[model samples]
Target: MTGRPATTTLWRPTGPEELALVRALDWRAWPPRLPEQPIFYPVLNEDYAIRIAREWNVPHSGVGFVTRFEVRSGFLSRYPVRRAGGRTILELWVPAEELPEFNAHIVGTVQVVHTFR
Candidate 1:
């Protein structure tokens, strides 16, 4: 696929508050598909996506800056090094049409680095 540069939002969890956001994002992104697990899945949800974007704008209380990159489809598989680093993170892929909401869920989680261009 063609490649292009796009901006994304990221967040670094520092404390409980940050962690809570991550948890919340996880829940939103992947709301409980089953009754038993409920909010434990890793699936992507529209609401969660929006939350990620919102969290990206907030100030992080941990190391490294939450960064997002909008690239083509092959970008992720090609640039593993640049995306490497940090611990305890979550990510989700959103279609271009739902980018706004997807971004919200991304930032709310832990450290986010999006690549959708």
Candidate 2:
């Protein structure tokens, strides 16, 4: 309630090419870690993180929220969810020029998840 609104993009993937882009981005941004495999946590690559923002179904002025969970003592603990919407959760701001490319990646990823599975 004290700062300016953030910006974002919402994209829906339509083809395999787009999906491949998204997957590539995801891999680049968040390389997999064998140590963390027990929890099945997705270590999203930076590129994929951007794609997630573009693919998120929210307004341009919305804020993005990213969360990480850890299991301890046979219990799952959740990180706090940010309240702002339309904002990307990454540490750096994604350039406007890259929005289109990121959106394409997101759309492609979604398409693959929905149809190919």
Candidate 3:
């Protein structure tokens, strides 16, 4: 196994603002943000995901959703980490053109963990 850890190392929790993008994707995955938004921010825990969904998304759009998915641990080293208001958020700096490649690293289907409406 190349001596790599046989374990799922990272699960990113996200609140997709574009619900349609989530529905339209193959894995219910979040499509990469626009080129203008070069950083794809995914938090490290479900609680923070839920909080963003409930606090920001629901209030702004009257609907909120939280999704969780496993990603290749090897990719973690490429990004920078930030602590935001009690949340551990990872900054995946994927330019818009490279999104397809990023999506391919996801290990499984993205699961919608919660909905606040």
Best by TM-score: 3
In the range 1-117, model 1's lDDT, one tens digit per residue, is 954344343332123343355458553332222334222212223334334334642334322222222333333332232212233334433334443344343323333443121
User: What TM-score number comes out for model 3?
Assistant: 0.74
Error of 3 at 57 (Å): 0.4
Across 1-117, the per-residue lDDT of candidate 2 in tens digits comes to 665223222222223433354457662222222342322222223344435544651233243333221112111112232322344432222234433433333211232222211
TM-score of each: 0.21, 0.22, 0.74
Write model 3 residue lDDT over 40-92, tens digit each, in one string: 77676667777778888888888787777777767655655667764454334
**Candidate 1 segments exceeding 4 Å error:** 8-13, 27-102, 105-109, 112-117
Overall lDDT per candidate, in order of appearance = 0.34, 0.31, 0.64
Locate the minimum summed-lDDT window of 10 residues in model 2: 68-77
Q: In model 3, what are the clashing residue pairs, if there are any?
A: none
The predictions' CA RMSDs to the true structure, in order, are 14.6, 16.3, 3.4
As a whole number from 0 to 100, the lDDT of residue 46 in candidate 1 is 30
Which regions in candidate 3 have their CA more than 4 angstroms from the true location? 1-17, 87-97
Query: Candidate 1 — number of clashing residue pairs?
Result: 19
